[model samples]
Target: MTLILFTQIFVGLALVFTVAAFGWRLRLFNALARPVDRSTPKGNPRLGILYAFTLGMAPWAKESTRRHGIAYLRGVAFHLGIFLVLGILILSPWLYLLPVTWRTLLALGAALGALLGLAGFIARFAEHNLKALSTPDDYTAVLVVSLFQASAGLWLVYAPALPLFYIVSAIMLVYAPFSKIRHCIYYAYSRLFFGKFVGSRAVLPHSQQGAR
Candidate 1:
């Protein structure tokens, strides 16, 4: 009975997120804000490449953190941890607990990645709430996601009543579409859009574009 209910919940959330993401991609609810990529890089080609890479990270790394002192660490941890955790979670045999020699390494990598992500989130929350740079929506989104992640971690630790953890995860999945957390998907496209848009406008110097 519990397993059936949990399976239903998972299927339901998957359907909703998939449909909502498709809707978002269709520009159903997204406001058509014009491109805001006016900050042009200087003549240094290496600097321009660096700028492009950093712009890719800017979506997750809140702009507000720059006013505070945590922009570097927050940006680094958030991006690198996201990369590591996402990669290992998808590719590692640990996903199925399959017998493999690399399971320990993958487990450690995932743990460290999650920890790094938590640190980044903590830094963002401190800068936002404690420093007064956060909007109400910002605070709410961060609080919700932080709680969701912490709950997931706890569930993994206790291994108790998988249904309860599934409930929490389901809530996270539903909330993510409506919250700033959707930026996880939105950011990648935004980066490519920015790059192509800039290139079309002849904003990037030729030497930088030719760098292969």
Candidate 2:
């Protein structure tokens, strides 16, 4: 088989595995009992959920994000880049059909995201608290993801690098469910739970605090 064909197979299997892993996780999460709130809600849960997915994610919304605004923004950019890369991957077979300007823009975004991922990886070791809290999986996941982003950017710039990008993508996808990256799947659930807890107590929107 040709190199491109092999890479394509690897990526296809990785995608299939990723989907199955997420499905299994979803089932497990669903099996867990969801706690019912018996207390009278002082604030609207719907509003709280809306805020959790929107304004509540702003840097100024939380003390931690506000204090570490740069870090938070970097993370946001990195994730945005990941999503963009995924789109590019899906359209890779016809990438040559895309306009040059669009390809360049996507490449630039992937490069920027790779840089941000590198910064995060370095920060894990440079920041004392982060260094203390980080495990081997954290370091490995960041490194693999950064390399994947870098390869993606290079592939966008030079078609010959497609194999490298595909290989890295396959590795990242296969490792995702077992590593710290799995948190990406659970992030929404965590936010939903937090919104429910805070909303029930009227702690989300300060205006609702008085109603409690």
Candidate 3:
């Protein structure tokens, strides 16, 4: 088989493995017992959930983000770039048909994201607390993802790099479910649980703040 064909097959199988792993994880999460709170709620659970997905994600919404605003923003941008790259990957077969301007813009975004990922990797080693908390898996995962983003950006600018990008993408996708990257899949559930707990206690969107 040609190099391109091999890359395509590798990526396809990687995608399938990723989907199956995530599905298993979802089932595992679902099988866990979720205890119901019988207590009366003082606030609106729906509103709290909305806040969890919205305002709660803002840099100023939490102390950690507020303290590390730049880092938080970097993370947000990196994730957005990942999402954009994923979309580009899906349309890669038809990429040549896209306008040059759009391709350039997308490439720029991917480059920026790769830079942010690199920054994160460096920070993990340079920051005292982060360094202390990080495991070898954390370093490997960040390095793989950063390289994937970089390869994607390069592929966007040079068609010859397509195989490299596909290889990196396949590696990242295959590793994600078993690594810290999988936390993304549980982000919504965590936020939902937090929103419900805080809403029931009227701890978030405090009644006093709501009144004002």
Candidate 4:
């Protein structure tokens, strides 16, 4: 088989394993005994869950995000780029059919995401408090993900560079379940639980339909 074919197979298998690993994790999480709140809820748990998935991501939604709005936005950009990369990978077969201007715009967006991710990686070392709080896994995860974005951006610009993108993507995907990247999967669940508890307890204001 050709190198491109080999890498495609490698990445395809890696993607499968990554999905399986994440699915297993979700299964385990679901199997865990859920803590029952015996207290009568003062507010709506459903409303809280809705807020958690929506307004809770707003800069003014959480204290930390509010305080570090720019950082939060950078993270948002990086993750958005990741989502774009996933879309590109999935639609790669028809990439050639896309208009040149559209492809260039998408490539630029991915490149910006890669830059933001790289900036975050640098901040982990440059910021004293952040550096102190970071572990090896944190650094490794950020670097690999930044590289993954970079590879994706390059592949978007030059289709001949696809093998590199696939290989890097394979590595990132395989390591995701074993590293801090797994937090991506857990983030939603944590937000959901937090919103439910806080809203039910009337601890945090829920972003109800009329309010949001």
Candidate 3 local lDDT, 109-191, one digit each (tens) = 99998999999999998999999999999999988988888988899899899999999999999999999989988998999
Model 4 spans > 4 angstroms off: 206-212
- The lDDT, on a scale of 0 to 1, for candidate 3 is 0.89
In the predicted model 2, the residue pairs found to clash are none
Worst 10 residues of 3 by lDDT: 203-212
In model 1, pairs of residues that clash are none
lDDT of 4 by residue, 1-212 (tens): 99888999999999999999999999999999987889977777777777778877788987988888899999999999888887877777678798989988888988898899999999999989999999999999988988888888898789899999899999999999999999989998899898898788766663353244
| CA RMSD per model (angstroms) | 6.4, 1.4, 1.7, 2.7
lDDT of 1 by residue, 10-126 (tens): 846764785687577648536667656565643444443444557534554446555554546654554554455335323322343544445445445444545655665566566
Q: Weakest 10 consecutive residues, lDDT, candidate 2?
A: 203-212
Candidate 1, residue 29: lDDT = 35
Candidate that scores best on lDDT: 3
lDDT of each: 0.52, 0.89, 0.89, 0.87
Relative to the true structure, candidate 4 reaches a TM of 0.93
Clashes of 1: 0
**Candidates ranked by lDDT:** 3, 2, 4, 1
